[model samples]
Target chain A: MSPETTVTFHTPSTLDEAFALLKEHGDDARVIAGGTALVVMMKQSLVVVDHLVSLASIPGLVGIDVREGAVHIGALTRHRDVETSPIVREHLPFLSDVYGRVATVRIRNSATVGGGLAHADPSQDPPAALMVLDARVRLVSPRGEREVAVAEMFRDYYETVLRSDELIAEVIVPIPSATARTAYLKFLPRNEDDYATVAVAALAEVANGTVQKLRVTLIAAGPTPVRAEAVEAALEGQSPTAEAIRAAADLVADAVDPMDDFRGAPDYKRDMAVVFTRRALERVLLAQG
Target chain B: MQLNVNGRTLEAEATGLATLVDVLRYELDLTGTKEACGVGVCGACTVLLDGRMVASCITLAAQAQGAQIQTIEGLGDRELLDPLQESFITDGGFQCGICTPGQLMAAKALLEHNPQPTEDEIKHWMMGNLCRCTGYYQIIESVANAANAARGDR
Candidate 1:
């Protein structure tokens, strides 16, 4: 669209209506929740669509509630709400902090959690936190609905496994264990609002000075949020110590494959990934102690 | 599309893909809300859609259908300026002034939800509203001064 392309806009009040609209239009239709990322892409002519199916009219899809030990955040819930919600603050304060750090208050007020996740930008702050929390994204289509782990959501840079007809409906974050300690550290070498050069999210359960459980994740260090499985493998049953943490974090250097960009070179990002992972794990371990 | 802008219901014809900033600037002629960065990074296009400050440059005009839109023009009339507007003028919160409208709106949203914001809150809220001229201390002080004035400390 050199000048501008006028597309048909569809406001579907119900999920079924939205599904039908998407089904009819297929790949030609695009679903927009807050339109923060999609609108920028559309303006840049990165994503051109003939039909825009807006989910703004859909009710019962913008509330955050606690259900069966999980925080059920409607896909349309604005980031501001998530950052300020008492329910989220009480149940998942780490998630609240993560959302609060995205962009600034103005952008967060309009950007939805579902929109952010579907945008699938690895540098975004939420994915690393969600991965550590084992969050799941609820996707709906004309065919059916299914839940996919947020960690498994992104396939590559600016890509996800979501089908064209499927719309992200909600994000389900399982409440962390009472004894679990979590930390999300975003390393921003540039300005505050800029995306992280390398971010880390770590959750661990330490009992009797031993590592009972651990989950370490990183963002903007690779094509997707890299789950540092090797890091976890090194310290799963070992004692928690400065030396052990460093050794385990070193494994992150192997797991990430970040592309060279303005943020940092691929090798630089890999190195910083290890540094951030160690720091994140140290914070969580200290909290456990 | 129908929009309730500045407490007035206005009717305008806009494309489905047209952003709210363009609709406000070109169609409605509400150029007070400037558009510096078409992307959402800069808050030059910030406006309150239903009491929440949003990047209107990235917001679709159609998404704003039935929502209450408030720009800097809506915040104050020609005769009486809003407290933030007054504070901005008094404290010299802006230099070139492209970011002033967005800064005012963001500050307005902050004070609405949080009547008494700490310096950190003001900074966090207004971080998106970048200024190329001022060093940001003046903007922070302006918001703080507005908050203090609103709190009857003036």
Candidate 2:
């Protein structure tokens, strides 16, 4: 089934107008920012909506600013902009690289940061990258506004904790500490544009030859972006040695619950998750900070 | 809806769900943009939206309402050819020619953004525009040679 022939597209110039349309249409209205994900879902009949509330005309929802010790990216900022933004490149080059790894230049030109996070596709790269950076998503509704950690945003496949009346306003990614080493390894053995079989993002810092801080996150290996807490628990405060890293990486095999697809079988994905996670950790943990 | 395509403004009677590819090919009769993978993976349906390359298959007609849409027809005509088009013919950038339009448009975008691209940059930027003929070497050469010719380095 395709979209109904008489779907109404509404371009709201203000967040208040968008909220009103969403509230009026209820389940039939979807907030479309870039249309990279929602349009495909509509084409595939996975989601059917009668009204499309586009945020394209909204002002003040598109910019990249560095302030308050974090980079505040507006909800409507496109992926290509984020990938090439000088502010992002300087403060968070690892994140810039991660954003650049998304589908292709064409897709990146149209996909947006807020839309990507709001879509909440578990296989996407940004969620894991943002999780490793300790990013927070700023949400707004007619009632009030709040912030949710990137790791806690996802509930399941294509599902988020966003309420029906709520909309994502911005994504605040606190710049990683200068001494930290971050790595994003996407295990896409097939097409460069394809999603990863298992993607890993890790940020680590070593002080006086011991692991001071470590954050491990993985995508495409579970329903949501999986944070390897057990691995972190085992490695934090421990010496950054090859044997210890291997032991900690092996814990990812039990942490992830990957689904079988053309990319790989469940067991194969689990194995690749461990392998990629270990490589990513080694790149950050064992490297000189 | 009003669409500005190839420097001409036209009216299209389409729904918000109608894709830009469908509008260009059916409503406005611009068939140069093809849709191979309707899910936005393939580059067959690529077009320039406001001077930037985008997947027309996944982009809605409503999305291109106020943007300048450029198709292969706008690149060059029979009277004259764009540098990239001439390079494709002189450099053997096509075999079956289904992916040629997309290849040219994607290359055109790259050249516009970066006038002189290295071999690695050419490959990296054009990797998404797949050619089923497996003539990647010729395609990459076409883009590189086009850039050089544009800069009078040939």
Candidate 3:
């Protein structure tokens, strides 16, 4: 049993108070919402913090709303909440589908969207889905508030651009066009609590039986979730035929630099990426039809 | 530190970093919440925090301060067990009973949210709580039984 350490648990009622607590504790503090990831890290001695600022008690930080053509998900909103939110389900069905496949329902009931992003795991499903959606994250500190593109928020493995005195306030995703369709696919060793071997999120607009615009993002294949530019480029101005989809999928596999791990070899992941990408694109095209 | 455990609020002199699992078992003498794995991977230390299931072993005691927490003890007693607890006993949901408390709590929360869940939904919801003793067939049956029992009561 690890010996208990002296720590302060600060519960803030508002965003301002939360930022103040973060500013006071700085590097010595860690913000906890669900504690699903951070707590395990603390127990393993991977992270040691003197202060834990609780974000669960904060108001207006646990909801999913649509405003001004953008979907705003509060930072403290639980994964389960987002998975079942009508707004998210109707507007971002791909995200809801990915959320349903995350960890487990119990963890999802406690795990927050911000914690998942703040943890910055390369293989996580939300970052991939959000990246393809071109989401923006709002950060609050004692100084003020600022927004950063989700694609730029990740610096490297288990690293984020958030300062110690900053807390992610919310994630904003612009509503997709009416002609657009999206899909997400995650390949895992098993179905439950298993990290993704390779996850893909694809969004495309089909205009008059041809692909007008496309965006594909791959997760868990590198240090950060990467946009599959080659695949997107290949899909542009092409029909949603099987041949075109296969060519785009091949481009994605060739573009990613996946590492070999205990779960799967690099070649296996690359193959699965191609296969899953084609399947996801097929599903989206069928839905559009 | 003070926390509302099971139902009645109690106070204890402990550090803020002490996990709720340690505080309940060691300090408050509520050893029902078992700690199979200190890590949150194994949900054997699950408890309800304001009607939501969370792994207590990973939750700090200070985090529970002034919050309503429900352990297995709060569900029922020997005299009158909750329907879910009764269903577990009737359906043979446990082979060793080591993971019973966590399983019961998780099932209880699932049924609370969704009074009638399909078999797939139950399995998906209960994935966090592991049971190596049983192949999880009986556990799923136990939750189904509990759901039926709750519906019958209504």
Candidate 4:
């Protein structure tokens, strides 16, 4: 059995206070948002901490807005808010659909955009979509602030590039061009609420019978959200014929490195990744009226 | 810490790690909220925190300190059953009865959010509240019936 530990909780109304609490608690402190994932880890003793500094009380950390050709989503914005936001629905409806499929409505109500990114689970839904959308997370700390592309956020399974003192302040997603169609496909063979066995997100712009631009990303297929760059390279400049799409989608089989779990074996997930990628590609490229 | 639970302000001495479910059940004797899969996956501990449905088992009491927390106990009693409770009983929404409170709370949240939700919307909203008895069809019917009853469509 693990040793018993009494935890202290702090709800700091400002980043300065939160930073000071982090300094006071040092390595024993952990930043909490929504507490959907972190609290579960705390209960199961997967992550033990002496102090939990909450960002809920902090102002200016919640809301969504379109500015400078991008959707600026506050770190504290809940998944449900993003799913239901008219702006997100109108500007990034595919993203809204992806957020709506996360876990369930109850979980979405409490899980925040930043918290989910900070949790950095490879099986999560948003990372693949965000990567395909070319979203970037603005991170803040007592030291200063910086932005990192969503494609570079994850380090490993359940690990991120976030420093202990740094918090994700906002996620800025560039609105895709009106002509670029996007699709997100999650293979949930089990419960609807369960994580995807292998998920795929694809965005493409086709003109004059040629693929002008394309981006593809996947989840639950690797240690981090895997970008199907090879697949993108093969199709971006070519006509998205069925043969071309199938050949490009087949490249994802060699791209992902999945672990064996109840969801599927490594071999099975790789196949599903290819299958879903193909399906998503067809939705964006060929299924149009 | 002081909590605004079910429209009443109460003091609780739960530790920082004590989840809202723990405080509501152990300290305040509001045992209507259950904990099955203690990790937020199972919606057995579903509650309304500041009018939003959340898994109380994963929400820290400290996190819910100032929020208006509503548990199953607040959803009316034996003398006056909530409309959802009435619908569940009338529609046979449960078999083993383990997931009833959560089903009711989640249904209540759904009806509050969308007073006239379609069958698809109800199913989507109540997807998190799992029923091992496979009483899903009845649960869905119950929520749909409740919505109809609220809107005088029954």
The prediction achieving the highest DockQ against the true structure is 1
lDDT for each residue of candidate 1 in B1-154, tens digit (9 for 90 to 100): 8888999999878888888988898889999988888898889899999998898989888889889999999898769999999999999998889998998998999999898999988887788888988899999999999999999999
lDDT of 4 by residue, A1-289 (tens): 1122488888899999999999899889889998888887778888888898999999999999999999999999999999999999999999999999899999999999999999898888999999999999999999999999999889988888988888999999999999999899889999778889999999999999999999999999999999999999999889999999999999999999998999999999989999999999999999787
Fnat value of model 1? 0.76
What lDDT is reached at residue A60 by model 2?
84
DockQ-wise, the better of 1 and 2 is: 1
Question: Per-residue alpha-carbon lDDT of model 2 for A51-92, expressed as tens digits?
Answer: 999999999889999999999999999999999999999999
In angstroms, the error of model 3 at A285 is 2.8
Q: Which ten residues in a row have the lowest lDDT in candidate 4 chain A?
A: A1-10
Poorest 10 consecutive residues by lDDT, candidate 2 chain A: A1-10
Candidate achieving the largest lDDT: 2
Model 1 pairs whose backbones collide: none
Q: lDDT by residue for model 3 over A142-177, one digit each (tens)?
A: 788999999889888889999877789899999889
**In candidate 2, which residue ranges exceed 4 Å CA deviation?**
A1-3
True contacts kept of each: 0.76, 0.64, 0.64, 0.76
Ranking by lDDT: 2, 4, 1, 3
Model 3, position A157, has a per-residue lDDT of: 87
Model 1 ranges with Cα > 4 A deviation:
A1-3, A287-289
Assess the local accuracy of residue A281 in candidate 2 as a C-alpha lDDT between 0 and 100.
90
